[model samples]
Target: TMDIRKNKIREAVQTFENLEHRMEPVATVRGVDFVNDSKATNVNSTWYALESMTKPTILVLGGVDKGNDYSLIKDLVEEKVKAIVCMGTDNSKIHEAFDGVVKLVDTANAQDAVQASFSLASPGDVVLLSPACASFDLFKNYEDRGKQFKDAVKSL
Candidate 1:
């Protein structure tokens, strides 16, 4: 079992390494780079996005939990995050995790959330909408949530 776990971790790590190589262009873009990583849904994926940011980052994090641990991104949150936008039914976890660490706000839907995140972002800042949980609290799925985020970016 332990060997299987190690192999799984190795494979996932390799996949993410590949992802990181491909994601540099997307993550490094100047201006408000709205990253709709709504499919992240877990603490690990959120940490990856936070680690990859090349600019001041406003991370949109929240939604129905498949059980999310806010601790994984703590160091990165303190380092890279300018603000946190909670886009979910309840924002308690997000607020609790980042209360004294950074500015926090809550928005119910995609459009308002994007607008609010954009407001917090400067021209070179990155707006990362990595929910670190499920999207059923608002939109249909991660794709729906991602598309809405893109549309909102276009509107901006």
Candidate 2:
């Protein structure tokens, strides 16, 4: 039993690939990588996504805010994110929370958010969709949001 478990663990580690919607790589356009982390519906998950980023990031954030405390990611945002694209109905909270921390812009949908994030990204930078809120405002679920983000990145 111990040997079987060890073998399974080794095989899984060698073949493991993370799920499509959580920290999934969508595409590389003009040297900038696009990533979908639409499963980040909470501050802690977004923190993990932001923490794993190795390059400057243009973050696509915003959805139906579940009273999210934007302060949770404030230091990480300041350290890693170059810009932010808000893709929610009301962006006032995001603006207020991130004002002076990083550049912020409001976008209507996934496509526009991707375009805006791309424009802000330079070569070696990344565009990441790690919305830290509920997807009910703009998508059927986190999977839908991630799919839309991937489609938009592919179109670019």
Candidate 3:
């Protein structure tokens, strides 16, 4: 039954525009792409997001700790991530996970995180907000988090 829908789904997807947030390209400042992937509420989802990155990335992560095992994206972070900006109330786990693997920094909110990511990025780099945890710790929901990300990018 699922397979029967494949062709139809493929056709629809081929014509579909990316929805706001969830890897949506918010803006391009200089040569950097600011992507809002605030819908990533789990490590697996973040893994996919990181895997899709073509240029060096400054990954903005953090939110409510979900007992996420960072090892799932360790190698991806190590290889593609140039720096990390933590935007949760608590970021100990984020530090522990990427301390030595990449440059890690903390931010009080999405705006701060976006600014920090921009500072860490260069031309041809990307700032990705693919938080691997829930948005409740920082915003009303994933949409709220994504909106903040977009607003910050627009400000820059």
Candidate 4:
């Protein structure tokens, strides 16, 4: 089993999003829904982010697929994602899995990915960069990936 305390905290955070669904929609705030889930090399983290969203979402997904099974987040993508912008050189699998389920775009670098995501997202929508794979594909590590995402978001 994993760390109980950490699991509890995650459960608590997810529960809050679940609860937020009940809140009535008021005014929509226009901002990029930037997410830095570059540590999700196993696919589960991407699934968590997708499941947690209550707003229109643009998913920025890419990186080295480590035996990834994209089907795991398929339904979540169809339900919450407004579009899918990839940030990797090789995106054959990501495209094959979600080509029709959502609009698909690709980027060779972080800047393009962020810009494309911003374009796909609108007010009250989220531009989520939850790469469900390894960061070594384009970045030195997960921290680098996260920092790039934050910088791009701040620039927007």
2 or 4, greater by TM-score: 2
**Candidate 1 Cα deviation (angstroms), residue 112:** 0.7
Q: TM-scores for all candidates?
A: 0.80, 0.92, 0.91, 0.80
Clash number for candidate 2: 0
lDDT by residue for model 4 (12-92), tens: 987854432121121222654465666666678789878888988888888988889999999999899889999987999
Clashing pairs in 1: 41-133
RMSD of each: 6.1, 1.9, 2.9, 7.0
lDDT per residue, candidate 1, 10-84, as tens digits?
999888655421232233333667666766778887888788888898888888977677988999999999999
> Candidates' lDDT values, in order?
0.80, 0.91, 0.91, 0.77
Model 4 Cα displacement at 112 (Å)? 0.7
**CA lDDT of 125 in candidate 2?**
99
Global local distance difference test of model 1: 0.80
- In terms of TM-score, the best-performing candidate is 2
Error of 2 at 22 (Å): 0.7
Candidate 4: the clashing residue pairs are 33-127
lDDT of 2 by residue, 37-88 (tens): 9999988889999999999999999999988898989999999999999998
Q: Which stretches of candidate 2 lie over 4 Å from their true place?
A: 1-7, 10-16
